[model samples]
Target: MPHINLLPWRELQRKQSQNKFVTILLLVVLVSFLSMYMLSTYYGNLRDGQNIKNSFLTTEIGHLDARIHEIRELDKKKESLQQRMRLIEDLQSSRNLGTQIMDEVAKIVPGGVYLTKLERRGSAIHVIGRSESNNRLSTMLRQVQNSYLLEKPTMQGIIAGEKSSRLLSDFNMEFYVKPFDKIGEAKQ
Candidate 1:
């Protein structure tokens, strides 16, 4: 064999191998960085879409809540109006109660009895009257009992008096006025 120097060729070969290795490492790093960027962008887009959907749902819920509140307010107002209407109807129906009571009292009065004063408090009527005899007062009480407008006649007091030189009895009595609706039902 000829005496050949192979060190230079061996050194060149080692350098070339190192260059190739460095280039492959750089390519791998670049590929990994690109993949990571793509994955991050995809996740960001998904998060943005979820946020938009959530915002829309929140807005819709707010509108529905407002409508529910309005409906509740309207219901309350309707109830209040209905209550007022009922009160007005009651007042209108009971307007003739005084006349009915007076008519019943006039019909029950006998010839020898005279009403002095009449007082009403709540559902009770206070009747002060003068009668010629106790029998006349008894008859008046019986008439009051049979009347549709009055009931529960109670004698509070009785005193002897002189009217036109004849003895008379002054009396105080209380009677309860029947409710208008009950009176109508009883008549029917």
Candidate 2:
């Protein structure tokens, strides 16, 4: 137990412990910083990937929207063409209506009945005529009523008149033209 100065040895031991503690603290701090950087970079990459996917979806959606618009336009055009076709069909069906009416009138008039004027009003025709006898005029009316292109013969007026020293009765009559579909069906 000689006097060797234990205070200096204890002081040196304290300094070494303090240095070791500092080194371990520095190591812990470096490891924490590296981990935080790695985590942040990984999250950033994930965000970038998500953004790319979102952009792709957006572009595809825009393309699909454009296609849908084109489809709508095509549908409208098709509908317009269909309407035009229907109009043409209607015109074609009614094309022979006037001819049919004239032919029917020629067949329906009796020999003693003369038609002076025939005027059309929508689906009805007003006829001005002179007849030799009431019986002849009535026969013409019966024929008109029974015609495939005519219907509903009605007498409007009758007047006794002299035409070129011949006995004639001036008369006014009305009749309806039969529907085109019905006329076609009846002829068939």
Candidate 3:
């Protein structure tokens, strides 16, 4: 028989099989690492996009807040102007009322009676005056009742003055002034 060594060849074949296994394992590990890296990059890009959207929304909210503040200021100014206009209208109406009231008061006063002091509280008029006698006072009350400027005249109080040489008698009266439509007409 011829002398032949097969042991070395068998050892070489085994070594080649081990090398193939190691190469396949290394390839699997590299593929898994690449997949993980790609997934992480995709998630990072998604987070960056969300952050950009949030910033844009924040800027829009800020602009809306400013507009709301400006609208509130304008509303305040409008209210102030409306109040001022109302006050001016009231003043103008009162100016015309004063003239009408004075004319009515002049027409109601008797020739002999003289008014010393006149005061007004709301719609009420308080008059302190001197008259010749009680008859004159009665006539004055009647004149006030018949006057177009006075309404619901109720005698509040009356007192006889002490004997004096002065031609004037002492008396005081309070009544309400009738509001006329003409006074309110000026507002229109």
Winning candidate number (TM-score): 1
Model 3: pairs clashing at backbone N, Cα or C within 3 Å: none
lDDT of 1 by residue, 54-126 (tens): 9999999999999999999999999999999988977887788888778888998888999999988988999
TM-score of each: 0.55, 0.54, 0.52
Task: Give me the candidate number with maximum lDDT.
Answer: 2
Q: Give Cα distance to truth, residue 100, candidate 1, Å.
A: 2.1
Query: Which lDDT tens digits does candidate 3 get at residues 1-188?
Result: 47788889989998999898899999999999999999999999999999999999999999999999999999999999999998888677666666777777787877888888988888888888877777877888898777666776666665655667356667878878665463344334
Clash count for candidate 3 is: 0
Candidate 2 lDDT, tens digit per residue, 104-150? 89999989889999999999999998998999988988998789889
Note the Cα lDDT for every prediction shown.
0.90, 0.91, 0.79
Lowest summed lDDT across 10 adjacent residues in model 3 is found at 179-188
Which segments of candidate 1 are over 4 A away from where they belong?
1-65, 163-167, 179-188
TM-score preference between candidates 1 and 2, better one? 1
User: Which of the predicted structures, 1 or 2, would earn the higher lDDT when compared with the native?
Assistant: 2
lDDT of 3: 0.79
